[model samples]
Target: MSSPDVPSMTGVHVVVMGVSGSGKSTVAAALAERLTLPFGEGDEFHGERNRALMAAGVPLTDADRAPWLLAVRDWMSAQAPTGSVVACSALRRAYRDVLRGALGDVLFLEVDVPAAVLRARMSARTEHFMPVSLLDSQLATLEPLAADEPGARVDGSASPAAVVEACLAAVRLRCDA
Candidate 1:
């Protein structure tokens, strides 16, 4: 169901990444469906303790996130051979490196939105374990993808469809190269 103008995602494993409230889940799900690829929810990989910590407005230490990152890496690695997409907050270069190490040349789609939009989005969330109080920490930790990274950034303020299209285009460009 992808538009003809868009390139086919034959072997691209995409990580839809950003800080909290950047629409990673929405964009990643749509992008995966558009490409007809399997999708994984990064939050689902979090251990109960991590979830609890976040729910209580406590920021996770890198130590707390390490095992979670490995779990996400393993999940992405399993899907990489077949081409899939996952929604994750791989906010740091080191985290992306972990995923790249596992998947081998993964493309990251970083969704960047304005702080106001992020705060609004966070305020509107209900069932999510991540609280608005933790967004500042997440944003503080977010490191934009390095120049050498194989990925592009999309505007999170755009419509989900537009964002998905942009992501597909980015993946096409990266994979074609």
Candidate 2:
């Protein structure tokens, strides 16, 4: 920790990002639990229109996503003093920029998974509104974390436990790793 009074995780915003069905929510929630931070489910920020579009297998455009990103950004800002772990698709660099704009140094944890695996996961899932048909759109729109971005990437193909372990390591900002 930077100071005796502060927790090491203080003000550390980690956005777990990936395409639909890539396990962003699972990894992020577990990471938050491990770090004892609040967790935000990105999908919950989606407007009714956005949800409807994804449910219909339609890809969301930048214009369509602007408000939703702002909402997520605002939520992060609200938790600024405490820090948070949020799961967001963050499919494009622009989307991530919105998040970073809210807090100057938000960390992004990109979860990478194969398209086939994403398809299988989306198909097997019964809860999410995102459809398997939209997987291609998400895959095509995904932009890996940029070199200048403050973040880390992990293989989402790993078990949920392994994914959480990897995320926790990154969120700690350890020097040894």
Candidate 3:
């Protein structure tokens, strides 16, 4: 469990989560850079088959997502002692639970954004394997952070800098508690 102290002083671990194009990577990387913590991109942990399935516009089933989620969770667990920030879709409560169990009470930074904005961002990106077509399924699968969760929901419609600032403020407040 994280102590109620400044995260930077206490080595807090955070997961920046959202559907594809919600700016999870951008905001998480910025936040990590600001906090001087190690950063990991969730997509990079996907297996070739998973990436291929997503690239083909197929929505991943829970069965298909399990291994990848466990990988991300393990990475987060490994980073815990040193503190880190990770960008993961973490679209379901079960997924977040896996992470929580691994990290033992980590903070989740949900990058909540409008559907239109998400579509626009997905359309603009060309290098990522996730197609805009899968956004609906992703959204459908997404379970927003609950009130009891140890984290904050951030507005992803804002600039990345703004989003990172908001995340920092929210996490700091949580840490201060």
* Candidate whose lDDT is highest: 3
Write one digit per residue (lDDT tens) for candidate 1, span 1-177.
457755556556789999999999999998888788889999999999999999999999989999999998888777765677899999899898888876545789999999889999999989889999998999999999887898999888988888888888888788767
Lowest lDDT 10-residue stretch of candidate 1: 1-10
Query: Model 3: per-residue lDDT, tens digit, 27-136?
Result: 99998887777899999999999999999999999999999988988887787777788999899989988888765458999999999999999999989889999999
In candidate 2, position 36 carries an lDDT of 74
Worst 10 residues of 3 by lDDT: 1-10
Off by over 4 Å in 3: 1-6, 9-11
> If scored against the real structure, what TM-score would every candidate get?
0.94, 0.92, 0.94
Cα lDDT tens digits, model 2, 60-100, are: 99999999999999999988887888999998898998999
C-alpha-based local distance difference test score of model 3: 0.88
TM-score of 1: 0.94
Task: Give model 3's clash tally.
Answer: 0
Residue 42 of candidate 3: its Cα lDDT?
A: 93
